[model samples]
Target: MADRPVPVKDLKLLDIKLGQLPGWLASRNYSPMGFVNGYRRGYNRFYSKYIDVKKGGIGGIAMLLTGYVLISYIWNYDHIKHERWRRYH
Candidate 1:
């Protein structure tokens, strides 16, 4: 016979220490400005590493343009389909 599963409450792994709460929260970058700053920092790093002309070259530019064009096409796909249908009918 298979062993039965144990209930989560019976496990000691889920225990939390109240004393660690403040320190944990303080260590995290949780504020709105902090989020924006973190995002900008990450984006800058990515741009420099992959999207910038010096490091990434033509391939990166091509990928960026292709992505933009793909997104634009998807965004206007419904409109383009409607226009084609209107013209045909």
Candidate 2:
């Protein structure tokens, strides 16, 4: 049988005592190395999910390209309109 999911009420984020605050803060890595490692882990996850050709395949590439084109058009829409207006005047 599959294991049941834990209820959210069972987890306490703000219910910790003042005495545990120091230990809890210390346990979370706040160093530069920690930042670099965290960035790499996040990047790897993003690449695997959206950028890797073998994993995301052609659909991901097409989506990314289409999104880029759409954003570019939206960003330059005002300038394009101005240029067209100037050409007619």
Candidate 3:
């Protein structure tokens, strides 16, 4: 018989959010939905992250989204400031 892993909930809490999915992405699987869908796949595969966000899982996803957003924002801010200073110099 084929072996199947048990449901993710039954797995330790640490396993679902920060384990196999990130490892898989680091090794491969560059698809956009990879992490978000992985969350659903681990949870119950019943909820959509998009709808969840729309209904207000904002707090949950916010930190993840904000890191990427603020990174680009700060990079752009610094780049523009550097260019202005260079033009003045």
Candidate 4:
């Protein structure tokens, strides 16, 4: 199961946008549907150009795992530092 390839349409990689709410709303002329569709169009374009079902899933999983480890390490370091500070102070 782990080696099974995912369908391209099901892989939602980097499909999110941030800080574009204001611009997207303005571009839509205050229409929610237009703004949402514009994002969908962009995401579709990105997926079509860069993402392949055969390759994307494995890469995405690897990236996610790497990111998780990195985040965990940083969070643990911060918590350890905080605990040491509290213990001594």
Candidate 5:
């Protein structure tokens, strides 16, 4: 890999573009629900590709539900154990 000298003009242009990011994001209306909706849309799109409704919708729902249950259990297991131990002690 070789380092190339960037022209001052190009550097200044890049700086100006980067500086506009915050203002651009602020100008657009974004909400927490919007973010959630976007995530759900993306997840559904990706999941749909691997899931076949013709075979059965239950299979897809079951997979997603089981994944959610396992992840939630693993994530909270430590906290739950801590609370239980505290109560016992």
Candidate 6:
């Protein structure tokens, strides 16, 4: 449990709204099974929540990446400032 990044129960909650993909596609006159990807069905089922724009799927990933990058910048800034401070003093 200590080594696992996410629990099975938590992962199970990630199951969301994949059941509606086919109906949505059908309303638009598209076949759900017509997609070229062989694993599209499975992917659609698993990643439906992550693909929802309203759920912040891609945007959330980008914001998280940006936050970590800024944290890294802050961490490195002290070292650079220390070097400059030494040079000036």
Strongest candidate by TM-score: 1
Q: Candidate 1's error at 39, in angstroms?
A: 3.9
Shift of residue 39 alpha carbon in model 5, Å: 12
List the candidate 2 regions with Cα displacement exceeding 4 Å: 1-46, 50-56
lDDT per residue as tens, model 3, 17-82: 665555434553357786776676755533344335546655546666787898898879977788
Worst 10 residues of 6 by lDDT: 7-16
RMSD of 3: 8.0
Query: What tens digits encode model 5's per-residue C-alpha lDDT throughout 5-87?
Result: 65433342245467665654554336898788768876877577657555655667787889999999999999989887775
Which pairs of residues collide in candidate 3? Answer: none
**Each candidate structure's count of clashing pairs:** 0, 0, 0, 0, 0, 0
Considering only N, C-alpha and C atoms within 3 Å, which residue pairs clash in candidate 4? none
TM-score rank, highest first?
A: 1, 2, 5, 4, 6, 3
lDDT (0 to 1) per candidate: 0.70, 0.72, 0.61, 0.61, 0.67, 0.57
Q: Write the per-residue lDDT of candidate 1 for residues 1-89, one digit (tens) a residue.
A: 99896543333333435665555456656899989987897678667877765545677668778989999999999999998877543
Determine which window of 10 residues in candidate 1 has minimal summed lDDT.
Answer: 7-16
Q: Candidate order by lDDT, highest to lowest?
A: 2, 1, 5, 4, 3, 6
> Candidate 4 on 14-85: residue-level lDDT in tens?
442555444443444347986788689876765665564655555555755787999998979977788777
Q: lDDT for model 6, on a 0 to 1 scale?
A: 0.57
Candidate 6: tens digits of C-alpha lDDT, residues 1-89: 57756433233324425775554444432355554443575566545545555546466567557879999989999887888767543
How far residue 20's Cα lies from its native spot in candidate 3, in Å, is: 12
Give the Cα-based TM-score of candidate 6 against the true structure: 0.29
Error of 5 at 50 (Å): 5.8
Candidates 4 and 5 compared: the better one by lDDT is: 5
Candidate with better TM-score, 4 vs 5: 5
Q: Which residue runs of candidate 1 sit more than 4 Å off their true CA positions? A: 1-35, 51-56
The better candidate by lDDT, 1 or 5, is 1
